[model samples]
Structures are given as structure tokens and as C-alpha cells.
Target: MTRKVPLANYLFTRLRQLGVGAVHGVPGDYTLRALDYLQPAGLRWIGSCNELNAGYAADGYARVKGISALFTTYGVGELSAINAVMGSYAEFSPVVHIVGTAPRNAYTSRAMVHHSLGDGNLRIFADMYAKVTAAQANLIDVKTAPETIDQTLEQCMVQSRPVYIELPSDMVAAQVPEVRLSVPLNVSPPKNTDEAEDHVVSAVLSRIYASKKPYILVDGLVAPDGIVDEVSEFARITGFPTFALTFGGGIIRGDLENFHGVHAGKFGTLDFTSYTDTADLALLFGPLLSDTNTLGWSTVPKKEITISLRRTAIELGPSSHNLHIKSFMQKLITRLDSSRLSARKPTPSLSSPRDLIKNLPEIDPSAAIDQDTFYLRISSFFRAGDIVICANGTPLVGGRDFVLPVGARLINSSIFLSVGHMLPAAQGIALVQCELAESGHTPGRTIFFEGDGSFQASAQELSTIIRYRLDVTIFIINNEGYAYERHIHGMDEEYNDVAPWRYLEAPSFFGAPTNGSYKIELHDVKTWGELDKVIKNAGFQDGKGLKMVNVRMGRDDVSTNFKAALQLAGRQLMADAK
Candidate 1:
């Protein structure tokens, strides 16, 4: 142990122990000291062009690494990153946010504070995120720093959401507090064999058994929680068709007989919607059911047995209920007496609507797969612990709905919901994975799927990818426009149109070393025949270089089969209006 360690060192060490191998962000006033210390502590400091992108980079890293961190200066930094932090909240990807501020005493004085952004500048990020974070602090109460940090990590790692911990500039040099790093990371989900686990399991199981139409739905609990296999076991035990309401993927695989598909918003599957809500017993495991994913709230089962692995304190009412997700899953698996499971309605053949859209003069392959199938296919690409970096626009369709392979992540502006988050997020995630790879830890990959509109936002990250020499496979869905915007505004031209860029030239323009930098490959497909080659390419798994595939489709076509979706939403809104 080195002597005279700074307060920042303690925070960094704490994070290092929690499996955070990298930190993402552009160093600012508050975070400069810690950023410097990070280099010496064997941490990779990844940079993005802006703080928002920095936060997004960190969020993506968190998705794959199980836990991730970002450091920035005060106010401006914190505010910019808020969207990404919230995105992580929406996806339930656990990430640690460290923002630098002045010493608590510095703000205590009444001297108009020369250093802040216009108006109230004292507490800064603390107030903005106190409600959403697991814990937060600065250096003033140096003694409590350790406790605060520990609790914050515990909360973030266990709950699998974004948490904020503000560190003052002076705190970076403060003395270390009393906290042992070798506490043996016991992150096992809530353990209970008897009343706790068994009771909850029996309740859910009995309900499912009684109701002719019961379904299993899960969310963020799968990743950052190390319980995907266990959840799969539980699903196998009960023969109820499963579908997730809040999607960060991995609740169920399309190949799996149990998984029906994720249904949400204007992009949800009408078939799945018709089958699931009609049930009497609806099990919501490790899910929030956020507003964006209302999933026809007016139509959801009147009764729901909600299960959360770390729902110690939640706000709920009479119509809904809760359960400790881990214990509930464990007990459910234990109680099953053989009798493997089966799907409710033989998961009908997955016929794509690509034909209808393709028949039109122009339809992008990237937008070819409906939200559900797109998510299903993307989920097929990775497993637990692999990072799935999502770009804005079309890519998030896969992020929000894809059934992740437990521990697989959904990285973007978690809640911030910004569009250009993908590449920057992947940069941070890859840097960490590269470090971990060097340390001989787990062999994992960082994959990013960029949208035409969103890719342009952080296209510079291709250079960053080559600068650090990371083996990140980026799949740029060259749809050449902002597809989602069209749906939102009644499919108008202006909302969906954008200046088309040579998607494959990004790496070449950035001077990726001839041999060192991965080659940026382009694929402009006009027909399904051409798309097959893009999807079947062996290069995706190797992840050797910056391979950019320009997928071209018919532009005159409006293949998005949102008719049923719009109809349902209209009906539901009308119902709620009454």
C-alpha cells in the first residue's frame, strides 16, 4: 500500500475493486486531479468530444463490464451527462458517476462564488441527482467518504442503475477513511430459502398455474446481477409464455420457446400484446415499467405480481405488488418438480414484414426488422458480460426491446435519451475491455451498432477506437436517415431525411494506421440477397478493425408496419381519456 494517498485514490481504488477497469470523460476542473491519478493506478481514461458523449461512453462501458465510471468537472459536466445517466437508469445498467466540485466549505461562504455557472452553484450535481442516486458526497465530511463510497457502490452494483458521487477538488487530496478493500465482493442477489424465497415463488407459480393465460416478464435484473442462467432455469420450470415490458434485452431469447418478445410503445408487436395483457397473472420481474414503456397501461392486467431483486424501498399501490427477484427466482427453480416447460402458443413462425417494405421503392434494412425481431437478432449476438453499445435512432430499438443474454448490456445516454451516444459509449467500453483483456481476465468483445443519423454525431470515435487500438466491431446501419423521427411525425420527409455520409470512409479519414487500424468495409444492399452477405460475414466475430458496412435500402418505401401499433395506441389513449 502506498502512503499519503489522495481522497481521489481511495475512490479510484474502490472502483478498481468493483471491476471498473476504465473511466470515460473529458477531464474538467473538478476531475483533473483524479483523472491524473487514474493513469498511474492502471485505469484507462477514455475521452469523448463532449461531456454528454463522455457519460454515454461510460454508460456503454458499464453495460459490458458490469460496472463503469466517468469523471468530470462540476455543474456543466454533470448537467451534460445527466441524459446518459438517466439512460442507464432506464436500461438498468449500473454505472458510477464521479463529478468534481469545490470543497463543501468553499461554497459555505456567502461571497457570490466567482467560479460557478449562472445562479445557484453550490451543491451542484448533489441536488440534481440526490433522488435518483444510491448515494453522494464531497470531501468536507472526509470521515464518511469511505462509508458513502461503499454504500454507493453497493447500491449501484446491486440495483444495477446509475449512482452519483460528487468529489470536491480538495477532497481529492484528503486523507483516506477507514474502509477495507478486501471485503470479498459478496454481490449475490438476495438469498432466501424459506418464507422469503419459497413463499414468493409459490405465489407466482400458483397464480401462473391457475390462470389459463399467465406470462413471465423480466428486465434489468438479468445483467449486472449475475442471474440470467438462474432466471432461465425459473422460466424452464414454469410453462408460461414470457414477454418483457421494459426492455434492456436478455429476459428471454427468441430461440427460446418461452420468450414471446418485448412489446412497447408505437413499435410493439400486436400479436404479443394481444396474448400477454389478456392474462390474469402477469409477473413483472426486475422491471420498472417506466412511462416510455407503458405497454398499453390501460390494458395491462389489473393484477401484477412484480418481483425485483433489490426492491428494498419502492413506491407502489393496491393494484400492484413486489417480490425480492433473486430469492423469488431461486425458490421458484427449487420448487419445480421436474416437468420442463413449453410456450403457450408454439411461438408462431417469425415472419418478417421486410417484404411489404422491400416491395416499396425504398426501405432500409436497418429499419427492416420490426422492433421485436431486431431486438431478438441483436440479443443473439452476445451473452452475459458482453457489452452491447447502442447508438441513437434505430439502434436503441434493439437496446430497449432486445432480450439480452443476462449480463449483456444496454449502453447509451441511459436516461438522457440523446442520439449520438453509441460510438463514444463504445469507445469507453472497449478501452475497459482492452485493459481487462490485457490483465488476462475474461475474454469479451465490445460491439456497437450505429444509426445513420446518430453515427454522424460521434463519428470521430472511429479515430478514438484506432488511437487506443481497440478491437471493437461497429455495425453502422446505413439507413441514411432518421427513421424513428418519421414515425413520430406522421412519416414526413423532413423528419426522416438527413445529409448522407460515406459511412465506410470514417476510419480512412481518421488515419487509422494502415495495418494497425482496422479496415472500414462498406456494404450497400438494395435487396435481401445483398443483406445476407452483411449479416453472415465472419468479420463481425473477429472484430479486427473498424469495419463500416453501408447498408442501402429503398428510400421511397415506408416499410414500418406501425399501423397496428398506432391503432392500439390511439385506442388505449382513448380508453384512458374516458
Candidate 2:
């Protein structure tokens, strides 16, 4: 006899199979019944404070665990999470967005639902999702539900982007063939033709062998494209000078002698840019060249001299070849003849962010912590395996300069540049780390650098973090408001200011245990000495549940790289005003 399971159970089971140990979302009337199936499917339910934060958390989880699921009710709930889903789409995070919609009869009768427009249009939300998600599935029939769910999830996994599944409330308990779960969904990319693979490999090798000065540029998409290991190996095998862009920071091992720090293009040091500009060939891996990621297009390598390996295609100079990036890279690595490849000596004189900090004048312990010196100084605090989350504004800009410890993963909004994303994202990332630790895997603490204004946007997620007792350390830069915005156009405008709060009281307010085994620690640091004390304290360094640090800086302070960019933006704004 063929086994049968509830439709919701089948869906949850599929997610669990794809490495989603927990589902993140707000429980609504439509999804409440389906939530009961989570435990049965061997999954945990993370009840987020709101749909947006849930979506953001799901995105974060996907970044760490490869794929994640988000459950939301119809119209209103899905709409609230659309922004985060879109960010996932743009940045290549695999998220399965399961939306619980009205019953089949309600859709047939065109019933005006409370969460929908009164005009009886219930399909509008799903239609909106179709634009942002890689694929969409509307499950109205139990007979086809199993296949639909598998195919939609496969799309999410293969494309590394969010996908939508509209599960009707009435169909939550509808019987579906459970036997289908025995056959794993095929999420792997189709194999490339031998001819095409050979041609691309030959073309890439020809350039590699001919060039005297070749460089490797690793971008953020390498991780999502599932080629980080291959790319890293290629860089290691070929003793070429390697550099990562802002978005690509921390993806590659930073400890390599050949690994120069992030290439900031026009904003970069003259010595580094001069060397990179003279390179005859560049092997660009997983290139995502959004303006912000590329420093307003300044950091983009010359296409004429670059070979770009993307998710689905390989760009050789002016032409693109249809090839699987992972397979292509694997084949290319196997065929590489190191004897023919040109080897360059490592340039040790180039100044990295670490070098900049070393060259700084002796610190005055009583001096207020400023943006220019903070990131460079704090770079020493990071350790291997740490998953660092930086917020959209100052953190993102300053964090690019971090000389991360080997194995540290930096999660920043590269293209979306969304505010309030990192805090909730920290909760999700930390949750995964906690799970890994429980499984006997060595996982580092989830460290987050957040701005006060960004923190206010999704602050309630802190309660979710505390409730789960996830291990996370948060450094809140208390600069009063949006310091990045202040640098752009408004220096002292009231509109840019955010209301002040007692940030150190967040853990207590969020319901973290005060005297129990899993306790929360808080620190307030305004000066360099205070920050050093907090960073060195044993309780703060090795705390269990949650630790919060409030580092206060000037409202107008901005990183050197960002200050130049923002000043140009301000000048442009002024010209437009004139």
C-alpha cells in the first residue's frame, strides 16, 4: 500500500530534507493549522515577531545552511515579506516561501478576504511574487501536490533564489502520496556538453598560460553558485595575486600570502590599484557587479581582459558560453598545468587594512572611538569560523576593510542595501551555528555589527533570538542615527536622526534570563579603553546566550572610503539642487 501524509507534512518534510532544520515565520490564522505538522516532520517552528523579519531570518538561514523555508499566510503576510524575498532573489539566497492561502472554495467563490483587497482579487499577491521568485506553485490538487512541491523546491535549490508555493488552507491536511519522499529531488545543474566544456577550459587556459601577470577576483556569488571550494583551489594552485571585492570579502581564506585585501577600485590605495590595473588577464569568479558592490562601477575589472565564470554561463572576454560554473571550474582545475602557468611573487609591500592599523599612531586610551580607527582596530577580534553580519550603512562600508580571520564568513547586503536586515539575520545565522555546535561541529560565535537606526527597524527580533537562547554577539554602533545618510546629503538634518534608546537594556527587555545558566551580558563603551575592556573580558568573550556591546561614536563619523564616495554623492546632489 502506498503511504499517504498530510500535504503540509509532506511540504515540511521536503524542507527538512533540504537542510532546513527550522522554519521561520509568523503564525497566522491561515497557517496555524499547518504549523502542527512541523514537529511531525522533524522541523522546529521559529515564531518571528513579524513577516518581514521572518523573511529576513529565512534568508540568513539559507545563507548558512544552503536553503531555508519561510511560512506566511496569504495576501497581507506574503506582501509584508516580499521585500526580504526580493532581496534573496537579488543576492541569490535559496528560500522556499510557503504561503498559506484561502481555501479552494474561497478562491472559486471569489470571496473578499480580510487580508486581501475587498474587490475579491486573491491571486494578486502570488502574481506579485512571480516577479521576484524563481518559480511559483499553486497547490489546489492533492494528486499533483507532491510533484509540484518537489519541482518548486528544486528550482529554489538550483537557482539559489527564493521560490513561492501557495498552499491553500483547506489543502493543509489533504492526503498526498508520501512515497515520493523516498526519491530525492534532483536539484543539481544539468551537465554541460563535453565539447562546450572543453572549448571553455581551453580558452581559459590559453589566457592563463599566455599572461605574465594574471589575477584572480572572487566575488560574492561564488558561495551561492556552489563553487567556493573550486575557486579557492584554483587560486591556491596558481600562485597568482588574488583580491576580493567588497561583496566578496571573507568568502575566500584571508590568510593566504597571495591574498591582497579587498580591491576598492577608485577608493583603493594607489599602489594596489596600479598593480591590478596592469594585470593582462583576470579570472573572475561568480561576478555580481552591482554599482554598490563595485563602488559605483569603479571596481569592475576591464571586460576585455577578464574571463567571468557565472552560475549558468562562462564569459570569455567578449563572448559567453553556456556552461555550468561548478562543473566548468572543476574541469578547468583538473586540466591546469602549473608548469605552464606564470607565477608571480607575492607583493608584501602593499598596504592591507591590517597594515593600516599597524601604521596608526599609538592610541590614546581616553579617545572616543571613531569610524576611521574602529574597523581596522577591531579586525583583530575576529576568529576562524565566526559568521559576521554587517548592517547596510556604515558597517557595510567599514567592514569591507576587515582583514578577516581564516574561515570567517561575512554576511552583508551587497545589492539590496536594505536597512534592519542584519539584526534578525544574526538570529538566524546564530541559530544555525548553535545547531552545528550541538552536532559536535566546531562553530564560532555569530558576531553582528549594527547601526542604532537599523537596529530599531527590526529590533523585536531580539526577543526571538533570546527566546531560542541562540549564541550571538551584537555590537551596536550608537552614532545617534543614520551616519551613512548624514555623510551623503544631510549633515545635521533632524530627519536623519533616530530616537535614542537604552540599548544595553535590550536583552533584559527581550526576556533573556537574568540569573539563569543562559544569561545575557551587556557593555557600554564610548572610549577606546572601555571597548578594549569589553573585548578582553572573559564573560563577554566566552558568554553563552547573548552579549550586547554599545559602542558610541560621533554622529558625523564615516569611514575613509565611504566619506569619499558620500562626498561625491553630496556634490552631485548639490549640483542637481543648483
Best by lDDT: 2
Per-residue lDDT of model 2, residues 1-578, tens digit only: 88899999999999988888999999899999999999999999999999999999999999999999999998889999999999999999999999998998888788987898988778888889999999999999888999999999999999999999998999999998889999999988889999989988998899999999888988999999998889888888886988888788887787777777788776653236777788788888888898888777777778899999899989887798988888888999999999997665666556566667678787789999998878878887888888988998888888877878878889887899788888888898998998898789988979999999999999999999889989889999999998888887888899899999999888778887867868788889999999988887777777367888999999888876568888887788899999
TM-score of each: 0.81, 0.97
Q: Give candidate 2's TM-score.
A: 0.97
The global C-alpha lDDT for each of the candidates, from Candidate 1 onward, is: 0.62, 0.88
Instruction: Report model 1's TM-score to 2 decimal places.
Output: 0.81
* Model 2 ranges with Cα > 4 A deviation: 269-271, 576-578
For the record, the alpha-carbon RMSD of candidate 1 to the native fold, in angstroms, is: 5.2
